[model samples]
Target: MSKICIVYHSGYGHTERLARAVERGAKSVEGTLVRTLSVDQVETHWSELDGADALIFGTPTYMGGVSAPFKAFLDSTGSRWASQAWKDKLAAGFTNSGSPSGDKFNTLVQLADVAAQHGMLWVSLGLLPRAPGPDGLELNRAGFFLGAGAQSPHGAPEVEAPPPQDLATGFALGARVARAAVRWKIAAGQPPTELATRA
Candidate 1:
């Protein structure tokens, strides 16, 4: 079975919702095992994460980058990187903020950079990079090709926001990771038993 772990830090529960969508998408695939862990739990769950086929990160954008807690989570992987524990593993990221142009790409880039530091393969969202719109040309509303990007409603509960498009975008990101992980594993001699395309 292919395993995908989603590690995330949610400041106001919005990112948590995005993470859930991602998890749901990943879990949709047959023979795929998925896990979602908050940033605070990474220390204890690091082993499980390291053993996974793919690790997808989610974090809220603060200032022009990821939140402090998520940064701490990334920093915690220093020893893991030193040993190249995640080498050859797949990596992707997602981020959320209050505004559409919150410089969220910086956070995704940082996540990808950290993954690279661990010798992991980075996965893109595989969508076009046009401006966000509810149109056929831009299925991912944030125009995020590097990773999923979400815009949450400021001062509103997560239940009331993040827009449907963002949630769907998050789901697509997770599904993409799962699909890629299975393909990679199969190519590495770990044949996936009839893996279905869930995305």
Candidate 2:
């Protein structure tokens, strides 16, 4: 079975909601096991993270980047980076902010950089932006390809913010990562020459 773990920080619960949507999508894939870990809880979940085949990161965008707590969590992975513990693992990220143009892309870049530092493969959102419709609920509405991006109105509760479209986009990201992980696992078991020939 392939294992997927989602690690995230939610300043006001919006990001957490998005993380859950991602978890649901990963679980939709048969033979996949999924888990979600809050940044605060990672101290005790290192083993779980290490065992995952793929990791999906989520965080709130604050001041054009990831929030302080999420940054701390990233920093805490220094030892993992040095050991290349996550090397060859698939990685993906999602972020949410109070405005559509909250410089959220920077947050995704930061997450991708972290994954790169750990020698992990990064997964793109693999979605195209949809024009605004009558209900304004369109997947990839924010037009970000690096990772999933979501906008939550200021002061809006988690249930109301990150509307259905962004959540759906997050789900797609998770499913994509999970599928990639499964394929990667299968490839890893093949002979080097066989893999090269297929490539």
Which model scores highest in lDDT?
Answer: 2
RMSD of 2: 2.9
TM-score of each: 0.88, 0.92
lDDT of each: 0.87, 0.90
In model 2, the Cα lDDT at residue 60 comes to: 97
Q: What is candidate 1's lDDT per residue for 48-125, written digit by digit as tens?
A: 897899999999999999999999888888888889989999999999998887999899999989989999999999
TM-score of 1: 0.88
| lDDT (Cα, 0-100) at 6 in candidate 1 | 96
For residues 47-86, what per-residue lDDT tens digits would candidate 2 score against the true structure?
9999999999999999999999999999999999998999
Residue 168 deviation, candidate 2, in Å?
Answer: 0.6
Q: Clashing residue pairs, candidate 2?
A: none
Query: Which residue ranges in model 1 land beyond 4 Å of their true spot?
Result: 129-138, 156-159, 190-199
For model 1, give the 10-residue run with minimal summed lDDT: 130-139
